[model samples]
Target: MRSGARAVLALGANVGHRAQTLHAAVEALGATDGITVEAVSTIVETAPVGAVPDQPDFLNAVVLVRTDLDPHALLAAAHAVEAGLGLDRSTKVPDGPRPIDVDVIAVGDLGDDVVLDEDGLVLPHPRAHERDFVLGPWAELDPDAVLPGAYGGRVVDLLTRLHHGEGPA
Candidate 1:
């Protein structure tokens, strides 16, 4: 495994062979030269996390990858996987159904104050601390992981609670 920093990527799929897409995503990340998958959280059945309604349940998981790529590059690679798997991103939408959703949850050794935003990608994934779908698998992968927000230890704690309930929203 390439040793730079480990990043937790949250994967969610609600349509079209969710398990296969998740597995393919793992393969795709492994396919990248600079990124090697270290561990993957077990698949979690979750509810929608936003205002979207009447959508199918999602199959979500967190993947811990050891990578040397910067946050933007890693995000771009994830977007590429979604695109390669037929996720449409031509429109500006939110919380709706999709083929696959991949997001960078946390980065290894980064303090809570770290954040990134360029083009469309954001580090610590803007909503990770508040969403169970992200935090559930995230905590499952790294129970002691710190987030990029001010939630401190509260976020992970809340995650353990929400994880037992529904995803979000």
Candidate 2:
């Protein structure tokens, strides 16, 4: 682990004390070793997006962090934060309601070309640019944010394209 690699994390919740859980999750993340919380986007509430959709709205936010941990370690740290906040992954259904969700949005800068396609992790979050829940808050925190990948682009531009139904076909 080094000292200043930037990473983006997305937090969400729809069960229990949603806002409180998110806040705690952020704090816990900041407290973790090899990670430093930088900025957090204003939490936004939105309807769930996925196959299992009969659930309550979710409060989501984006977190900017300076981390020394590698991608997989960062992911493990995120999962730890999720579990500490009452998210039982084994019992949780995909897209189902949960107390917390910590998503690894992106690691490293656009020029770095940080791409990862390992067994349990994918860099730049394959669907980040397409989901407003992630982009909206991300744009709020970083207007110039550029998602790096085959389906990637400027955060604000992607959000605009999504609203216009102009996503890649």
Candidate 3:
């Protein structure tokens, strides 16, 4: 059997029972094959980012999991959970409100960096560091968390930098 890889996942919900949706999503992730949720951050409320305005604020949280599934497989599992939670990708607007959103923040060490722009999956989420909704809760869960890639840095540092308007270097 292959050893499980440590992964970080960001969760958010803005429509219908936000907190409950986040909780259920975490539970669903734990119940998935080859995935075991080890830790979860406290959920925080934040205004939505990007386009698609005139929506409710979001409840966001982060989870750490040990998984035997590879990057793409894990992404598939996340999408499955979203589907089960009634997140219809077909009808949803880009960057719009949703019942649930799950993003693969990072996977394993990969030491240098892991870049995958194909197959609808991106490792070490391209914009994770820029979003406080992702970094804030993540920092609470793992103070020492360092994003795994070239643009990566300490989670808390990234959050601080963002707060100071420094952005990622």
Candidate 4:
């Protein structure tokens, strides 16, 4: 059997039962073949980012998973989990509120600074370092987590810097 690669995922939901949607997404991910959820961060509620004004606040969390699937397959699995939870990206406005949102933030060490602009995927989630919703929960799950590449730094440090107005705008 091939060794599983470690990947980080960010999850959020602002519509319906937010908490339940997030939890269910995690569970669904674990149920997929070749994907094993290793660690999950505590859920945090935060105001929407990039949403239309007056949009509902979101329930957000981060998860670490081990998967034998390659990066592309892993991404597809993440999207599948989102779709299963009622996230219809095709019809939803970008950054809009949703039943569930699952993003592949990074994929192993290869994800460090590696830029891939495929049709529907991007690695290292270009703006992850700038978002408290992503970094905060990530730090909780892996204090030693480093973004790697040009955005190099520990997750906790990134979150601290972002909190203090030092991170990217």
Candidate 5:
């Protein structure tokens, strides 16, 4: 990432003081040097995505950021943010709700098929195409950045569909 490269981050949480966790995440990210939060969508409550549902709904939001840090560094910073807020790595259930969940949605101008996680950053998120928790709030910030072709629907359209259908928790 250069001086002007921007990335979108998707955040969600459903357990143990959710709203406060969201606030903490925003604060932590904002506090990280070389990173500036450009935009933030409203904190919306939605059901959890994927399985292992024995939990409550989540407060989800998307953050647009301008950073000079590379995608891998930014991802490390995000993980630090989560850990700073008390994320237990011991939890084995993947995608399962917790005190906080921060995901790298898109980085700079990366492609959908590209894998950033191997480089310590993930883009277009591995499961973003199937997640309303991420897509709904994400669309609020950068609807045009949504995937193309089969996923041509604007973020708003996806949000609407999710709200109208069985989505998020």
Candidate 6:
């Protein structure tokens, strides 16, 4: 394994033991070979957002991890964790309800933000800077968190901007 690099993950679930599923995800990530669960933000319940909005509210939280795994490998682990906890993306509506959804918010150390664009993974999570579900919990977990990339800055500031209606559309 490589030396540990930091990564932020956002987890949400609106179906099947939402809180428990998020907790289990934290435990699972902690147990993964190359990942160490660092801190977890308080879970927040919020109305569903995105294409499919007529769904149950979602319980969302952020998990910070220090990992030796590369970005893609870490994402694979997240997907595996989601699958193990009952999320079947193949059968769900796009942006619809699911038992668990794990998203990579950002990857890199405290000051250095990594940028990547691939088929299924995009670092700094293209829209993380805009989603309160992601930003709120992230700000709570890491007070000094910085999101690197376009539309990126201090997490707190981003969240403030989002709340002030200053975020991207």
77-140 per-residue lDDT for model 5 (tens digits): 9888888877876763686868888888777667555665576454656566667767767777
What's the number of clashes in each of the models? 0, 0, 0, 0, 6, 0
Where in model 4 is the C-alpha error above 4 Å?
A: none
- Per-residue accuracy of model 3 over 1-169 as CA lDDT, tens digit each: 4469999999999999999999999999999999999899999999988897789999999999999999999998999999999899889788899999999989897534466656667678888878898899889988999987777888899899999999885
Higher-scoring candidate on lDDT, 5 or 6:
6
Candidate that beats the other on lDDT, 2 or 5, i.e. the better one: 2
Tens digits of lDDT, candidate 2, 4-40: 7889999999999999999999999999999999899
Residue 8, model 4: lDDT of 91
Error of 2 at 121 (Å): 0.3
Ranking by lDDT: 3, 2, 6, 4, 1, 5
| CA shift of 38, model 5, Å | 0.8
Model 3 vs truth, CA RMSD? 1.9
Root-mean-square deviation (CA) per prediction = 3.1, 2.5, 1.9, 1.9, 3.6, 2.7
lDDT per residue (tens digit) for residues 49-159 in model 1: 678878999999989899898877888888898899889888626888888888877676554546564656555566776777777677777777766555545457767
Runs of candidate 2 exceeding 4 Å displacement: 110-119
Clashing pairs in 3: none
lDDT of 4 by residue, 60-153 (tens): 9999999999888888898899889998878988888789998988888875557565745767788888989999888888888887656756
Candidate 3, superposed: residue stretches over 4 Å from native: 111-113
**If the candidates were sorted by their TM-score against the true structure, best first, what order would they fall in?**
3, 4, 2, 6, 1, 5
Cα-based lDDT for every prediction: 0.78, 0.89, 0.89, 0.86, 0.75, 0.87
- Any idea what lDDT model 1 has? 0.78
Candidate 1 wrong stretches, greater than 4 Å:
111-115, 154-156, 161-169
The positional error of residue 30 in candidate 1, measured at the CA in angstroms, is 0.9
Candidate 1, 138: how far from true, in Å? 2.2
